[model samples]
Each structure stands twice: as structure tokens, then as C-alpha cells.
Target chain A: MSANWRLNVAVLYPELLNLYGDRGNARALERRCQARGIDAEITPVVIGDHWSPDDTDIILVGGGQDREQRRVQSDLHRRGAALRDYIEDDGVVLAVCGGFQLFGQHYRGWDGEIMEGIAIFDAVAAHPGPSIQRCVGNVVAIWEGETVVGFENHGGRTYLNEGQQAFASVVSGFGNNGGDGLEGARRRNAFGTYLHGAVLPKNPRLADRLIALALQRRYGSDAPALSPLDDRAALRAHAEALRAAFSPAESAIGRRFA
Target chain B: MRSLGSGGTALPGLVVERLHDGAAGALAGQLSATALITGTNGKTTSAAMLARILRADDRAVIHNRSGSNLMRGVTASLVEAASLLGTLPRRTTAVFEADEAALSAIAAAAPPSVAVFTNLMRDQLDRYGEIETIARRWTEALGGFPGDATLALNIDDPLIASLESQWSGSSVRYGIEDPDVPPAPEGEIMDAVWDPETQDEFRYTRRYFAQLGRWHTDAGARRPVPQVAADQIDNAEQGVSFTLRFPAGERTLSLPAEGLYSVYNALAAAAAATALGVPPDTICSALESHQAAFGRQEDLLVNQRRVRVLLGKNPSGLNQALRTLQAPGERHHLLILLNDGVADGVDVSWIWDVDWESQAPHCRSVVVGGDRAADMALRLEYAGFPAPRAEVTRDTGEALSRALSGVPEHEQLVILPTYTAMLEVRQRFGRMGASRLWDVA
Candidate 1:
């Protein structure tokens, strides 16, 4: 076990990319580390700010509204090479919803305008427009043989390229797009998904996985195994989210005739 | 119109619209000038303030002060004021609060002479997608507004303030200028902050709730455009005395409303009233007489105990509500209702954005209710509230009953609920004979 090691998470574009409590995922990662007695610090990567891979272990970004997404997409373009460099050097990255779309090739906007991305993954997302329903609900997925439960709310239909891998299989809700049966994208230590009950507080396992990956990238093989923490409440919350994900009943008012 | 009985705030409008197509516009045209207040958080309060002032000036106001801010709601209020052939009441002015989602349609169909823009905050993400979507949509819609129309805006919100350039009509911008407020304290989670002025990345000198960073334009100057601002504010627990400053002059007035957000609403209403040419003295008096809309810091008695209902439909609103409930050393009997009704925004995940931890310690006993009650209870548990102490249920009536059961007479119970849930909770209070207006609440 490594005697002393600290993990620094660079939450990219937190101010603009926050949607559906995605910031909670960052908090989840922090709490998991605290529960395990691992040293960790979360630094927000707001607009016009830069992060160093040397001090950063994990890069996390969440979803945002379309216009904000475009803004973040532009800022991300400025840091494209730095992000790629961070990933190339083995820094762990986590992106969700709009962030997931932006981390890929690019996203087609609701207006049919093209909003470019950093293309960290060989993928692209397109909003099918307001005519089609936004995939929004509690959704469960099977990831690395465990159930991953969270919430999904997005209009963009993300399609992975030939070589990209899916992060998980949709167990209940819409995955990427409703037709794909797949959710998010994965490659090495970088992960992206639509599961945002902030994705971590309920799916503590994924939070631990990200934390462990950050630790491994920092401490290498000497990283100690994280002690199991009590997650009964989180699991219950996950169960509730899974139940909600399975139910597609729309509110009487929000429902649109599909 | 007086025979709605209860919960029928929007029915008359719907009936009128059904009987006469384009009734919203036809009826609006008959008034001296119509005004529509729209935004995420302060719609009801702002609409109430404006309506009260207009009515105070002997300008009969046709308004929906019952918290129904939809097209049907506004149309119903107008319907009640108009004749069978659609002639509006003489000297009557239409003052309505339009929902953010319904604003574009409302503006396009019946462009009010005075359209006020209250600050936009993250609200009902499931219902609105993102607040920017509504902002962009409003900008496009307003670009086509009648040239005679006047837009009153909140320059404090970067998103709403950014839309000033879109309006070809006359406009007034309003905001809070107190350094003491410190911009409401940024919540645990934030999603928007970029310098609208310089187009440079924005950094907050002091963060506030929802990262409603000091609004700046692309050039990096706060209030770059002239705006009607609250020049000086002296705040208190239950009310505030503020000096309102506009291009014309400054008038100090007091409102019984609580929170900096309520003050922003007052500023917005004041700006709108001034734009409509209502005298400053009249505006001040109306504000003094203004009562907060139901469920907006509304205190009522139920089952012989005092209760306060604070409406919270989204993350920022809920966070602000919780923040207001937190007294340094005081505890509370809290009934939190989370519904996924369309009005409530089905994406319950936004609850995670709320700083429940800050309010957890202040809860003596929590009763979590509504459609998403279980999820809310789980959130409270995760927020560090003792799991065993909180009573959780989906039945609003049962939950409120449980919450109010053992409370002593001295302790006031607090009820915080989402939009639809607020309606349902109020209905339950009505059924239980706990509402002040037992038959109509």
C-alpha cells in the first residue's frame, strides 16, 4: 500500500456544465475518498482557467443546457490539446450528459447548428429536435457486472464510432439514444455517461472506481485497496432510482403525444 | 368568475379562449396597457406587487394572483373582466404572471405594453431543459415584439440582462445593488457563470446562490447598461427597507416580504410600474400594501398551529427556501413535498443540487411527501438527517398530518413544496380545514 498519496480532481467547466446536480458526482467522489481515508482535493475548472496534469488526477465535467453547452464547447476547444495531453498521460476523466456529448466528436444542436466538441472520444451526439422526446428519467445500467443506477435527461442522441466502447448497457432507461441500448462511452481511465443522479452518490461503486483509478494513476501498483464503506442508504437510493427508471409514466402535464 | 370554488384560477381563461379564439389578444387590447411578468422564481410575487400598485391607482386590474401563471390562467382572469362579446372592463389594466415556458407564446400572441424580465435561475430543469433555452427563446420572441412595447428587465441575471439587445422596444433594467447581500451565496452546485461583458471567463468576486455571479456584459462591466437598481437596502428578518433608484429618481420603500429574492421581485415590479408611468408614491404605497402570493413565505394556521409554506420548484429556489429556514440556533418542523408533476419538473435529480446539509441540522422532524417522497427522504438521509426520524410517504395528506401531529403550539411548522406539490399540499390543507381560506386556498 502506498504510504502517502493525494488525488486532485479537476472539475472542468463546473459553473457552465452543471445540469441536474452533476456537481453532486464531484462531491460523491470526494466523500468516497474521505470515507477511505485517502487525501483528495477538488479544484473547479471554471471559464478562463487552466489545470495541470501534474497536480490533477481526475478530470470531471457534467451536462448543461444547450447554449451553455455551446459556450463550454468553445472553451473546451481552447484547451483541446491540454485535455488530450492529460488523457494521453493517463489522467482519469469523467464526463456526463452534455459533457459526454462535448467530449466526443461534437453535438448537433436543436436548431440544426453544429456545436463542435474536443473529440476525446470517437463519437458524436445530435439533438433530434423538440419533436422528439428528451430522454429524462431515473435509469439503471449494468457496468462491469454491477448495476449502475442514476438519472438521464438529455435531448441529444449520442452515437459511438466504430472503435469506441460503451460504458454500460442500459438496463432500464434510454441509453445514449433510445435505440442504441448502450449508454455513454469508455476508454481506459476516461468514462462518460448519462447517469446523473449525479451518477455517484447512488452508484457508489462507480464513485469508488473513479477514485481508485485516480489513486492508481497517482500511486501506481502501490495503491492500497479501499476499505468497504457502508453504503446502505446509497444502495436504497439506487434502488429507488432504479425503480423510477423503470417507470416511464410522464406527468399529466409534461406528457406529449409521441 | 367569483364562483371558481377553488383551484380554478385558469379555467375561466380556458373557457373564454375556447369560446372566442384569440381572446388573450382581443381582451388585452381593451386595457390602458397590459403587463406580463415572467421568470423562474419571482413571477407570482412580482405580478402581485404590480397588480396591487395598479389597482391602488384606481386602475382596475385583471390578474391571476392565485399562482397560476399559464396562458389559460391569464386568459381566465381577462375572461372574468370581459363581456360576452369580449369587451374588457373600462379603465381595467391586465397584469399577469406568465410562466417561463409559456412566455414566448404569450408574448407572441398578446404582446403586453410592459413585459418585465425577472432574474432567471435554475428551475424545473425537467420542465424547461435549461434556463438559457427559455432566455434564448424569449430573445427570439421579443425580437418581434410590437415597437410600442416596453421591456422591464433584471440586470442582475447575466442571462436575462443579455437579452436587452434583442428588444427593439423601450426597456427598463432593474437589480439589487446592496453589497451587504453579497449576491445570495452560491449553492453547493452551480452551472452558469461566464463574463457576458468581456466574453472572457468570469470569476466571481463573491459567489452567491446558483452562481448568479455579479452580472457582467461582454465588456466586463457590471450594469454596463443603465438600470433601475435598489441603491441602498436595509434588511431585516421579516421585511426590508430599500432605496429604489432609477433614471428618474429614488424612493425609499418597505416590503413585508422576506429574502433578497423577494426584494428583487419588488425592484422588478417597481421598474415595471415606473415604465407604465404609475406615480412613484402610488408604487410605494402599493408595495407597502402588497401581500406575497400564496405559498411564497405565506404564513397560515392549520389545526390550531401556525404554518409557513415556501414554494420551491427547482434547485436554486429550493436552496434559497432552505437557506431562509435556517436560523442560527433554531430548529424546525419541516414538511418537504417533492412531486414530479409536469409543473414540478419530473427530473428529481435537481434536488441533489440543493444544500440540504445546511438545513438538515435545523430540522427537528422532517416529513417528506409527494410523488417523489421516497427519493426526497433518501436525499435527507444522505444529507445526514437521521433516517429514522424523518417520516416519508407519497400521500400529501398523510405526510402533513404526521408532520403537524406532535408539534407544540409555539413552534411554527414549515412546508416547502414544488409547484404542483404546493398546489396539492394547499388543497390538502383546505380539505383539513387548515387553510386560512378553507374553501378557496
Candidate 2:
């Protein structure tokens, strides 16, 4: 692919899935790509709208609530074929929280309500019994040898099927669930995790990795060399978030910056 | 019923709950009448507006006036209003603004005569689940409420408007009917766009920053019900003027609160007040004299600097505040505080969803302070706010000092803070012995 090729990105269900500022992941990807001198265009695929990954290189799906999740559940089933095709074609997909759950095999609520997932990743997202507590707070995950810190507020206890790789090991915060101490799932070119909000801003390395992967997939692994910008401020923010995520006292107080 | 100590708000309720968890709802159930105002935002402003109108109509009422909307807060207010004998006086009305999550407990304990459903927005994601989850819970709570209760609904928000028919109650729907913006709410994060009936997305024809929609009631599957509506909003510097349309008649009035959202709040208050038999003139005059709730567009003099405090808890509220600030006038200094406390919804990422680019143009200088001060500064810088950049202080007081020192006396300084941040900031200014919000009757 030419260096000037504008990367076509599809932000699936952006209007509905942008829970807890999960849209920041899209922003981080866009800004990072632009700063690296790569032209990128984002098209939002709202409900009832039609779009395909014909030439799209990256698809981002953020988190949503259970009701919203259910609303999109059937729609996801209809596009199950297209979703599987996109992942099979080596397209990079990033799904957060509810989005992550939907890209899996299926999600089962404690109430026996079953939401069918697209099966982009081999996993099952389940909720604890109705009265069980929710998993919420700033989180730090060990990803690619870097401490990827972000905020996670979700209730899904996603379990990866055997032979599937985990995105990031749980360092702090309830990962996929409190039991496994693991978070997110990675298979092929698709990625799913519970971290929202600061996932991109707090972890520039991971953001760059996603972008780089998209570039490599589109440009036959010979993507243009990327440039780096000063991330001192971003790193400071990440450091503080990581510290806060580990400290129960600080986490309880808030996403502490001081 | 009296200030026994320098105790914090909700302290009494917290203590009573330890002794007895059900004391609050039990005490509230005996009131002559009850009205609950609830949603993601504007509960206090709308509830206070309705409560004031009720008072003007000469109705004996005691409301949860301190902006405490939780179950415990409800219990405390009811406990306070009740006598030592555990019974309220005759003809006493209780109007309370309930937190979204607390609505179920309150509804089960003491079903209201009228419940005003305000527009829901993405707020405190770290605390509350998604907007859809909150909506589902709200629907569940309404199911548990008295069957014949009246629902005051915001039709502009497709989500809330859709609930009118789902509730087995008489409904009064209200919405912004401005010519420029549609009567229904439509924009990013609008949950009502996907029409369930059509099995397709409902594309709004009008341009709306977030407000759009028509007024209609759906009783059940394919069954339409009659409902009242509001529209033709004209926003002015002082506040907003709009025409309120009811089944019997329609009336036009100007509210003293700023922005179209505040106008929506007035309409919500009007709907609830009308259900309680308030005269149109009484509602109008009461609203004209009403003030925005504490830390919500409230004006205060802090350390000799005149400042306006506005609550910026969620993306929608912050967007509206920013839109209002984009007035075709002079630029303003800004002091923004962002906290992720439990009440504030610790998932600090929602700040990213806010349209800070539009806000950057209206801000001449900025001082960001709070638990997430650095994050705010980072966003501002990314939005391309010119340098000699925003002053970042983790300490709220130090942040206020920096902001005051930068602005001249004549200029307006807007301090936008999240929930817990607003509480602490107000406490700082309140300690100076200025007027207090609860001091009002």
C-alpha cells in the first residue's frame, strides 16, 4: 500500500456503544495516526445503517449497557457473517467491554437472558447472579511487556475458550472476572477488553500497537516507519492512573491525579 | 428539623439507616401527596422548581430540599418531616428528587402521586451502569409504582418519552418545540433513534445539538394515548422563554434560568405542578423567581472574585454549559474541576466524549483542578487551546486562587465542576459564612 493511502476505519455503533467515554479509543487511534503522518477517515455505522469492511482496515466497537447491548444483539447476529469475514481477512478490530462481550461466542445474563455474539473471538461473557456486585474502577493490565493502564467499569465475567490467547494479564482490578485474574481476549487480528475511557490516552504504546497492526495488515507488513511524539504529559497521566488503580484508598477517592 | 450540629448532609439518614433501613420510605408513605423528580441530570433544579410552585399554591409541603436524592437522603428528609410519633401532619406534601438507582426503593416504599421523568444522559459511568441499564431499572421501578400514578415525561428524549406508555398511569409529556431544533432529542448518544416499531433507525430531519422530538403517548403495543407537550423555545441571556401546551390550554412564560435545558427543566416542573392543580400564573411566577439548584449555574463571590458555578457532571450537561457559554460576547476565564468519586462516577473517561473543541473557543484562560485535573489539561491541550497553557492544580483551593489571580474583577469566571468536586468547592465558599442553599424555606 502507498504511504498516502487514507486508512478507511469503521466505528461500529459509535452512537450507542460510547459508554464511559469509550469513544476515546477512536480518538486516540485517529490522533495517533494523524500525528504519524497517516491519513485516516472514520465512518460511523449507527443502528439500521449499512456498512462493510470492503476496504476498511480498522473497526472499533466500544461498550454499552445491557439494554443497549440487547438492542444490538440481533443486529449483530445478522452481521455475524460479515464480522467473521472481517476478522478472517486479517482486519484489526478493537472491542471494549460490552462490545467485547458481543464479539465473543455469546453472553448470558444471570436472569437467563441470552445475547448472541458474533464469535469473532472464542469466549463467553457471563454475568454473576442478579445480586452479585459489578466490577468497576481504574485498571492496570500487563500487555506486551508494558503496563497498560486504563479505567474499566463492567460486569461481564468473560472466559476465554481454550487455545485462545488473553490480551492482558490482570495486574490490578478484576480482569475478565475476579476468579481468573485475567482480562481481555485476543485471537487472530481481533482484540476485546473491559478497559474504557483512558484505554487509549493512558496507554499510548498499546494504541500505537493497534495502529501499527492495522498498518501492517493493510500494507503487507511493510507499513511506513512511524514517528514518535513527546508523551511526557500522557505518561504522567498514565502513571497517576496506574497508581490510583492499585491503591484502594485512592481508587475509592476517585481517578486520583495527585 | 433543626441544625443540631455541624454535621454533613445525609449524616442523620446514614445513622437512622443503621438503626432501621426501612424508616425512610415508611415515614414518607403517609404524606398527603408525593411527587418524585428523577433522571440522570436536572433532578434538583426541576424538583426545586416544582416544590416552589407547590408552596406558592399554598400547599403544605416538605421536600428533600438539600439536594440529597439517595434512599438515605429520602429517609432523612421523611424522618425530619415526621413527628417523634412517626406520623406527618395533615395536608403535608412531600416532593423529592430521587437518584436514578434509588428510585426503585423509594417507589416500593412510597409510591408518588406524580413522578417526573427527566431526560437521561451518560453520567457517572463508574457509578451507574450504561444509560440503557438505568432506563431498564427505571422501567422496573415504574412497574412497582402505584398503577394510577401520573408520569411527567420528557418527550424530547426518546428514551424517557418512550416510557410514558409503558407505565400504567396518566401521562403529561413535555419537550422543547423550538423551530430551529426539533421537538425531540437527536444527536450522538441518543438512545431513542432506533424506533422499535419500524425496526429501523429514526433519522431526525431537524438540526439538534441534543434536543429533538414530537409529543405522543404509546400506551402499549401499537396503542397511542393522549399526552400534553411543550415547544417553541427562545433562549435569552437571562434564561429561556417557551410555550407550554396542555390538553385544556396552552400558556407562554419566560423562565429565569439560563439555557434551553433549564427551559426543559421548567417545563418538567410545570408538568408536575399542573398535575397537583397549580394555577398557570402561580407556576409562571414561581419559575420566574426560581434559582438553578446548588452548584448548577449558581453565582457566588469566592475570595472577592465573582464567579458562576455550573455543574458539569456528564457529557450532555457539559455540552449544554459549553453551548450556553458560546454566547456572541466577550471571552471568559474558566475553572473546571473533575472528580471520580463514587457519586461523581469514577470512570473519568466520559470527559473524552465532551465536545471540548467548541468550549476551547469560549475560554480565554483556564485553571483545571480536581482528582482528574491533569486529564482535563491534557484534553484542553489536545483541543488546541493556545499556550501559556492551562494552569493545573490538584488542590481545589490552589486552583481557585490561580484562576482568580488571572482574571480581572469585571470579567465573568465560570467554574464547572463534577458532583463531589462541586460539594467540596461549595463547602469551601460556604465556610466563609455566605448564604447557604438549604437556608431557604
Candidate 3:
């Protein structure tokens, strides 16, 4: 990527949103990009028509209460084509918890109402009471070659697209796929689920992979050689420690998926 | 009759006596029914609002207007409401706010005709332990409700919604549809911090900040459109005007007490009142006229200095109060006193959840008191605060006096205490003949 070209990330509905700390994902993304001389602009857009995929290199969506889910489901549908095209055109979209539900086909709200969603991700989200699973523990994503750490707290069950693959395998704890126990989703350029440790910051390998993908799309065959940032080691250590604290059993077992 | 203590001898004894005598007889006898209003956040406000609405229609509704829902507290209210002759007033309707812990005991004593659950969120962890435990307890108690009983619940709460499958009676749900109340807020530095010890605590995502705003059903549903609105927010005065919309029409309700969460309580109350067939006008008018409950948000005075006591137990409650404070540019003298037991908890690690970096920096010399005053000191030090003239006194009265000493007698002193601490602080100020509790105390 050119040094002059900064990565712009638009976090939609950060205020009127989800139950998990999904914004941590955006902050982590910004911090990672800034370390590599990339300027990241994180702007919050509420329920309005001013949002467009052109201004953003990536889109981040968070979770919220059932009342908020109902409100935003209708509001997002009003945006229609703008959001549809954004996902179809391979916009790097990161949706966490409720945001993930909104991107799917529909959400079966706690009130038993079938709220329409953006349908970018093939999933059906439903409110099934307050599930306090305390999504702690280390998750080793083989694609990243290291332990990817984050927390998950969601009550909806996600049905993945027939042909789509999960974001990661649940080496330790449950994730978006519900009782079957999957970690997240990685379909096209979209990465979505209930993992809210701002997954990118601690899991720099995933952040680097996304950045590499962004470079390949923006610069085609001319992407530059990549190297780890200086503070990457310390950051990884902190992330690993948190994951260890969350997964005392696995820390005891010394389990490594990769 | 089971005796609770010396305090129970007066009224608790009588209520227990009635429960024992009337258990078999009252079941067969014809009399008024009871309504229970519950949840982690809005139990008190909704109960009071519902009571006022029932009373407006010339109904003798008995309620714990003083905001006491514990075993002792409810017993006191019930004993006081019953006649000196030990007979519950005829044509009297019982509307009581129940703590999540006491729901099972209260449920066994008296089965409610209608139960109103506002929403569940993290509040007092040290007391309640886990949010899921509270949810399970509520569900168990709710199971005891008769098949014909009405369930007036917030469809927006995932925890409460789970009860739909268990309840045999008709369930009426409500939500908000205000164009102004944003969907929810995004994650921040605050979101990254988590305490696994208190994992059951519901972390804030986007939507409702500390229990404000209303919810609507997802798109098309058969239920009534539930919307709650806070028409005006007076931070200095600490009150809001809330409006709840039902099938009949919109009921414009006003909460004399402040805090964004109170608005949700008003909605839950209105929903329960509406289900009970209370008139919309009466529901609206009663909410506006109702006064503050004791220790919930009651104000007091120390040496004639006006002190407002706000109950802060969980992250949401503290965040709600912090959000309500005006900028220093608007108002000056505000003293914040937090108890470790009531507000902080034994862990005290969740102090990081309070946007203390913003709130602590803005407040005028906050005084740390209570069981773990030093824990508060540690939190303040980490949040970029200079040594905040700490008063390590365990006595809440001394802390109240010290915190209010600098602030002028005319200006309001914001005393944010824990549950028992608020009671203790209020009792001290009450003896001084300065606490304006119930506007009659």
C-alpha cells in the first residue's frame, strides 16, 4: 500500500448497538495500522443515510440490547442498497454479536418477531435469554499459526452459509455457531462473531493477514514485503497472558491447536 | 408466624400471622389480588409508579413506597399498610417491589396476579453474586405464579424473554421506538477491561446506557408497540419526564427522581399498570406526582447543607449517574462519596468500569469512604488522579459531614453511597431533622 493512502474504518452504530465491547475491534485495528505508518480514521455513524462504502476501507459493527436490535434492524434495512453493495463489493466488514445478527438473513427477536437483516452473512440470529457463558480462554486459529485470544458473550445461534467456512475452530470454548461450538466467521472479506477482545489487537497475525489482503486488493501485484512491528512481541505476550488467565484449564493442559 | 427480629415484632409479626392464618382461608376467600414488580434495575420506580396509578382510581393500593424490598423491608411496609386490627384493608390492592434475592420467599408467601420484570443487567455483584443466579431465582419464583396470572415483561431483555416458554398465562411485552434514542454505543478502552470473577455481569455494548431509553419488537409482531421516552433531563435537579406508549395511547409520565435508568422503571410500571386496566391518564398523572423512595435516590441535609443520596452498586448504575452530571462549566460544588460494600463490592476491581478518568477528574475533591476506602484510593491513583484528599473514616456520618463541609449550605451535595450506607447516611441525617425523604420525613 502507498504511504500516502491511509486506511479509513467506519464503525457503524457504535453508540446505539450491542451487548459486547465490539468497538475494541476497531481500536485494535487502528492501533495495528498506525504502528505500520498507516493513518486510521475511526468515525461513528448512527441511524442515518450519509454512510457509504467509498469513505471506508473497513466497516465495524457492535452488539446491543434486544430493544436496540429491533430498532437498528429496521434502520439498517432502510439503508438497503448502500449496505448491500458495500458487503457484495468485498468491503472488509467486522461485525460483533448483535451486529453479526444484523448482517445475517434475519433475527428471531425475544418477542418472537422476525426482524429482517442485511443478509450479507447467511445466518439466523435469535434471542434465547441471557446466556452468561463468560467466554474466556485461549483459541488457537491454525491459519494464524499462534493462539488468537478474545472473549465471547452472546445469546443467539448463528447458522453459517452452506458453502462458507467458520472464522476459526473452537480449540477451547464456544463461539457464534452456538451449541455446536465454532469460534467466528470468515466469509469473503467479512469477519464476524461474538469475540470482543478487539480480536485484532492481541491477534496481530489475523490483523496482518487482513492488512495483506487489503494491500493485495488495493495494489494488486505490487504489495510490499511485510515485517512484524517492534512492539508486536510485548503485545503478543500480554494477549497470551490474558488468554491464559481466561483458560486456566487449558493453561494447565498446555493445549495448542496449531 | 416466623419472627424476623425485634423490628419484625411490630408489623412483620402481623404480616406473617396473616400469611399463616389466611394461607388456606384467603385462597378460598374473596379479596383483592397482589402485583409484583421486579428486575435488577427498575423494581422500585415501577412499583411506586404502579401504586400511584392504582391509587389514582380510588383503589387502596398497598406498596413499599419507602423503597425497601428485603424481607425486613417488605414486612415493615406490609405491617404498616395493614390495619391496627391486623386485617388488611378491604378493596386494597398490593403492589410491591421485590429484590431479586427475596423473590422466591415473597413468591411463596403471596402469589402475584401480574409480575412485571423490567430488564436484567449487572448492578450489585457482591450482594446478588451472579446475574444468571438472579435470573434463575426469578424464573423459579415466576414458575410459582398461577396459570391465569399476567406477565408484563420487557421483550428486549434476553434473560426475561426466556421466561415466555415457562409462563402459562398471557404475556404482554413492551419496547421503545423513539427516533432520538440511538441503537447503542460502540466499544472503548472501557470495554477491553473484564473481570472474570464477575462474568455474569452484562457488559454494555451499544444501546441502552445504564438502563435508559425504550425498546420495540423486531419489525412485525402481534404484541403491542412498547416505547418509552425521557422528555426532559434535569441533572442538577436530578429528575426526568418519561412517556410510555400503550395500545390505547401514549401515557406521558414524569419521574421526580433523576437517573436515565429511572425512565425504564417508569415504563415497566406503566406497562404493569396498563395490564391491570388502569386508565392511561391515571398512569401518566400518578408517575408525575410520585415522589422519591427512601435510599433509592432520597436527598438529605447535614448541618443544613442539602445532600442528595444516589444508590450506586454496579457499573451501569455508576455510569448512569456519571452521565447525568453537568459539566463543571454548568455547576460547581458536587461531592461524591462511595461505600466499598454497597457500591464497589468486595472485589473492588470493577472500579475500572466506572468512567472514573472522566468523572473523577471533573468532580470537586471526591472523598473516599466505607469498608474499602483504600481500594477507592488505589483506583483513583490509577485513573490519573492526584492524591484526592482521602477521609478513611468508616462512619458514613463523618464522611457525609466532611464531604459536605466545603460545599456551601445552599448548593446541593451529591452523596453517592451503597445500599446499607445510604440507609445509614439517611438515618443519621434523618435524626438531625434535615433529610427530606418522602417529602414528609
Interface RMSD for each of the candidates: 1.9, 1.6, 9.6
Best by DockQ: 2
Show the lowest summed lDDT stretch of 10 residues, model 1 chain A: A249-258
Lowest-sum lDDT 10-residue window in model 3 chain A: A133-142
Candidate 3, B389-422: lDDT as tens digits? 5455467777766777767766767776665566
Q: Compared with the true structure, what per-residue lDDT tens digits does model 1 show for residues B1-441? A: 011124547777778778877877777777788888988778888888898888888888888756778878877787777777768768887887888778877776567889988767777776676665776778766876778989898776666766777776679877766666655553466545654334564455545566554654345455444467875676666677888877777889888866677778888888998898888888888898776666888777777778889998777777777777776887888888888766677678888878888887988877777777767776787688755344454577778878888588757888898887777776776666665423334
TM-score of candidate 2 to 2 decimals = 0.89
TM-scores for all candidates?
0.89, 0.89, 0.57
For model 2 chain B, where is the 10-residue window of minimal lDDT?
Answer: B217-226
CA RMSD, predictions in order: 3.8, 4.2, 11.2
| Docking outcome class, model 1 | medium
Candidate 3 Cα RMSD (Å):
11.2
**Backbone clash numbers for all candidates listed:** 17, 7, 29
Candidate 1 C-alpha lDDT tens digits along A130-227: 88888876677889999998778888899999989999988777788877688899977889898787678888788888888888887889887889
